[model samples]
Target chain A: MNVIVCVKQIPDPALPGALDGATNTLKRDGKLILDDSDAYGVEMALQLVDAAGGGEVSIISMAPNGETAGMRTALAMGAAKGILVSDPALQGSDALTTAKVLAAAAQRLGGADLIIAATESSDGYTGTVPEQMAEVLGLPSVTFAKKVKIDGGVLKADRQTEEGYDEVECALPALISVTAGVVEPRYPSFKGIMAAKSKPVEEVTASDLGVTPAGWAGAGQKVMLVAQAEARQAGEIVEDDGESFGKIVAFLENLKVI
Target chain B: MAINSVWVFAQVTNGAATTGTLELLTKARSLSPNVTAVLGGDASGVAAQLGEFGATKVYATGDLAGKLPGVAVAGAMKAIIDGGDKPDLILFPQNYEGRDVLARLSVKLNKSVLTNSIDVAVDGDSVNATTPIFGGNTLVTTTFTGEGPYLVAFRPKSFAAEASGGAPAAIAAASVPDLGATGGAKVTAVHVEESTGPKLDEANIVVSGGRGLGEADKYAMIEELAKLLKGAPGASRAIVDAGWVPYSYQVGQTGKVVKPSVYIAAGISGATQHMVGMKGAKNIIAINKDKEAPIFGIADLGIVGDVHKVLPKLIEALKGR
Candidate 1:
């Protein structure tokens, strides 16, 4: 079975002020890492291919020019090939538009028996794309999956729910979006790192996929990004004395916590 | 042709209706009088309650005794989309089940899915959704420009619960196609964490302990206060990793995101990850030994004192209240 994994290069969320001052957008700085959830998806796909007695695992990503480092990381993790769908036109696209571009690219790749993605993007945190891509490609999508396995041409997965979890089974050529607990993504080794350089990467443009600027723009909703986020003010610290306990009690009482 | 109506996924568990079902119905009622509440379960007499919640029409799919919610929601959404009764907006609660179903339905229907929205207002030919980004530090208002139904998942406990007062409407049982083979793994067993406190996500008041408490045993102070308030116990990532508290109660970037009305952080330094989970809280209180703990910045009330001393006193004050 052939598997495809959709990966994203998000900004290091640990950094302060990771947004660009001029564009009012997230600044890809410090480090461009594979979205943590997508790494799990990639790992799941690799395991599936290996279990199937050697199938191909293709890594797909959409990002700005600086995200090539992330693409290379996926290659080093053991994907047979990489596909990067990047262009200046694809910038500023919201979750919906991003799904459209990805769906179009997946279609151009001649499709696959299985598609995998993280539950949500760390930066966007939308958690909407995998389902959106499945809709666009007319496939069944099972999301928030904690465990997945392929048996007898059927894909079985354990999905997490509030009450607990439910076991489910679906046929091949389906999409699965994994949660964090699914698998621990393996780090690249020296041998894998050396092999990644020779791995062929296919690059595609939005225009080449017939996704025009207007067509690629989001249609459902408009997002009004706030100009600035006001930082919280520094607070006072009372001394660690008997008097401090009274002050703390008084504060909680005033806040109605008492 | 007349616009059909807006659809709200009226989720019911163990025959009890969820709070979000009513909230979404209220929002849908405001958008258009033609609102349908689709309930997927065999719970008796739920249609009458749905009508009280402002549902003009009620569709009960049947009893979902052995069915997965993801399967039920996808089937119901598909039926609504295919019955020549296309909804302009599809609202879901940003809960675990809601997210799963909406994510699949959005893809199946080719609609834009928006999650963690705080507010939704109807605009001409579209809806404007307000969702927080970069945690609750900033709010982004989004509108979709396409022709499909606008899908949104509202954060739980964000909207005020509206009273459902109207008379019952004639119930209709809608037929939904079963998407063969749920496709994926099946659950073998469930291990529920045994605890005796209010659920952290649903609690109105939450008292969270952080690393500043210094040790796992010190959590007793935090628990005492929670008990006094008849609220739930929560913890920061610092405490969870130290095994001071269960991972279920941990609130941070990697744990549950909650929006309780009142949140008290004891000994928490307020890392951004921890802040993102509770920043939507209506009011915040912080108590720490350090004068410059980051949590104090967003806190409406702050007491810079040792939590070991401060929490005991606060618990005493609450006992007196």
Candidate 2:
């Protein structure tokens, strides 16, 4: 079972992220890391490949300035190879355009039996690209997956819902967005890190994938304004003087929630 | 470019229209007098409710049974749109089903979607959507620059769901086109987590525990407090990621956005992502040992204490009452 995981290289979310004043988009000129969310997908893909006995796991990512630092992390985690779709024209692409570019790159890889991705990226947080990719590829998608198991060419997933979870089953050549914490991602060992440095990572452009005029030129949406949100006023602050619980109870009583 | 018509992708759970759908309907009605509800499941039961929220028409597909709603629902809406329906905008809630349908529909229509919106304003052919960034510290207003049938997904509780006391909406049957292999997913079973008190999002009071509680077992204090107050237990993403609680119990930007009457956060040191979820609460009470935790910035009452001592005392005090 060949699996292709769509990974995202994002500005380290731990640090502050700033938007470009000119483009009204998040600045991406800094060093990027593999989104922590996508690690669950990559780990799950590796496990699925292992379970299937013998298949390769490939990583596909779109980043600016030929960024492969994020892809190198995924490759170290046991993915066979990597494909990075980078282009100056792909700077301001929206999610739909992203789906198109990534979808095109996946097709260029001659497709896989299954594709996996995080339910959403930490930086973008659009949470729609996996399904959009599935749509562009005309494949079935099962999202918000908490648990996944493969049996007899069918994929079964415990899909998370508001109330609980739904047991969903889909055919092969499909896409699934796995939720975080579903699996424990392993840290790359020294040997694996050394191997990842030599792993073949093919870099391509929008024209190479036939998604020319990508980014803002192909985007259907534009940011009109960016402003400070109305700040929530800070109320009273009290050091716990041992009777703090009484204060809490009194506050609840005032709200009539007690 | 005037929004001649607006459509809401309605969702139904437990045989009734969801509150999020009604909220969207309420907002859609305000934006355009001509409001249509596009439902994926049977609309027979909720047609009147849809109308009460100002949806004049409900274009629905027959029962989906257990099939995944994305392919069939998007296909049904595509059929309606292709059959001469000219809605300028389609609104969706940022929920599971809504996101699924909106994503597929964006691809089907070759359009883009703006999601996690808190507000939308109609401006003569342009619909500006306001979305929070950096965890509600800043807001960005985006507008559709493309063709019609704009798709936007709003977070739940973005608007109130008020009924207009209108007649039952007229229902129009829409067919799901042959999906071939694209509609191959099926739901084989459903497992609802057993809950003893109010749901986390629906509760009037939410008591969430975080990593400062020290260990997983201490989460019981949160449940105890929530139960004593007749509310629901919640968790910070840290604890949820640490496997102390289910992801469903998480309250954060990536989890459930909750706006309870009173939200008591224990041990959670207000990350921007966590703050985005509960900042809308009418009353915020935070308890953490660190006095400078960012959570204190927006907290209505910040208790500079440890959850270990504070939660127990609070639970005991509430029980005594």
Candidate 3:
């Protein structure tokens, strides 16, 4: 079984990111690193490949400036190879357009038995790419998966929902988006890190994957304006007068929450 | 400059409309005069509530029985729209099930989806949804460039759920198309993690812990405090990411969006992702040792103290310590 995992190289989200006022886009000129959210997907893909007797785990990422730093992390974790899709035309791409490029990349790879992705990107957080990719690929998609297993050519998962959990099973050649904590991500060993440096990384442009700018350029929706979010009004700050707990209790009581 | 009709993919759980669905329906009322609910399973139990929230008509796909319902819902709705009986705008809750249905619908309809919308407003005949990007640093107002049956998903609790004194909607049966061999990923079994008290999203007061809790074991204090206050226990993305808690406990942009009446942040530094989920809280009380934590900016009450010390004390104080 072969698996493809989608990832993104994002500016460190721990630090604040700036917007290009002129373009109203996130400034991506800063140093980028592997988004932590993608790690679970990578880990899930690796484990799935390992459990399937012998298989390869490949990564598909769309990065600015042709950044492979993030994808390298997954490669270091034992993924066989990586593909980076970068192009200026791809800049400011919306969720569906990005999914188109990814699906096209999957086609270039001659397709895979399955594709996996994070439930949502830590940066974009749109939570639509996986489903969109599934649509483009014309495959079944099980999202928010907490547990995934493959047996007898059947892909089964415990998909998470607001109510609780649902047990879902689908045939191979499907797509899945795993939530964080689906599995504990393993640390890349030093040996694995050294081996990753030699792993071949394939680079391609959007058109190289047969994605024409005109096809996705004018996304169905357009971002009209971006403004600083209004700050939630500050209410009160209190010091521990050896009775701060009491004050909170009183506050909650006053609000009738208790 | 008016939307002819609005459709909400109403979510029903245990024979009632989820608060988030009702909330979306409530907001949908303001956006369009003709509001309809596109629901799954029998709408009989939830029809009254959906109506009370301003649903004029209920379009249900009957009962899905065991299928996940999303695929069939999308297929059914696609048939409806293709039949030229399309709503001007469609709204869905930003949930696992909701995203699945809407995303598939986006493909089936050859449209795109606008998700994580914080708010929506009318501009001429177009409906623009405000979505916070850069982890809530900036808000971008987006609207479709062309065509009808626009798809948009609003975050849970983005709008308040209120009754409009409307009569029960006229419930109509909708056909569920045949789900293929995959069977919408057949649900085989279900396991509900046992816990006491109300659900986190529905709770009036929510107490969430962050990485400051040190370890998974310390989350007990959070459950304790939530119990004392009769609230629900929630966790920041930090702890949930660190494997300290289940994703179900996560409250944030990427997780569950909550807007309880009172939200207490214990040891949470309040990352933008986490803040997006609960910032709508009527009152926010943050407890963290770092006085400079960004959470203080939005906190209705900021308590500068370590969770290790503050939580136990608060729990003990409530226990008459």
Every model's Cα RMSD, please? 4.3, 1.2, 2.1
Give the alpha carbon lDDT tens digit for every residue of A88-200 in model 1. 77776666678778878777777888999987877777777787677667676677777899989888887766655667676678888887657768898889889998998
For residues A182-219, what per-residue lDDT tens digits would candidate 3 score against the true structure? 88888899998989899988999988998875333457
Clashing pairs in 3: B41-B62
Give DockQ per model, in order: 0.37, 0.81, 0.65
lDDT of 2 by residue, A1-258 (tens): 899999999998878779998999998889999999999999999999999999999999999999999999999999999899999998998899999999999999899999999999999899899999999999999999999989999999999998899999999989999998889899988888899999999999989998875578778888999999889998989999888999999999898876
The docking category that best describes candidate 1 is acceptable
Residue-by-residue lDDT tens digits, candidate 3, B126-238: 77989887556678998787886888888876788889988899988788666564344677777777668988887998999998888899999999899988899999988
Supply candidate 2's per-residue lDDT for A241.
Answer: 85
Estimated TM-score for each candidate: 0.82, 0.98, 0.95
The lDDT ranking, best first, is 2, 3, 1
Ranked by TM-score, the better of candidates 1 and 2 is 2
Off by over 4 Å in 2: none
Looking at candidate 1, what is the lDDT of residue A110?
A: 78
Reference-based lDDT, residue A111, model 2: 96
Better of 1 and 2 by DockQ: 2
Top-DockQ candidate index:
2
Q: Against the native chain B, what TM-score does each candidate's chain B reach?
A: 0.85, 0.98, 0.92
**Tens digits of per-residue lDDT for model 1 on B8-100?**
888875566777788887777777788887776653567677778778787777865445566566777688678877777778887666776
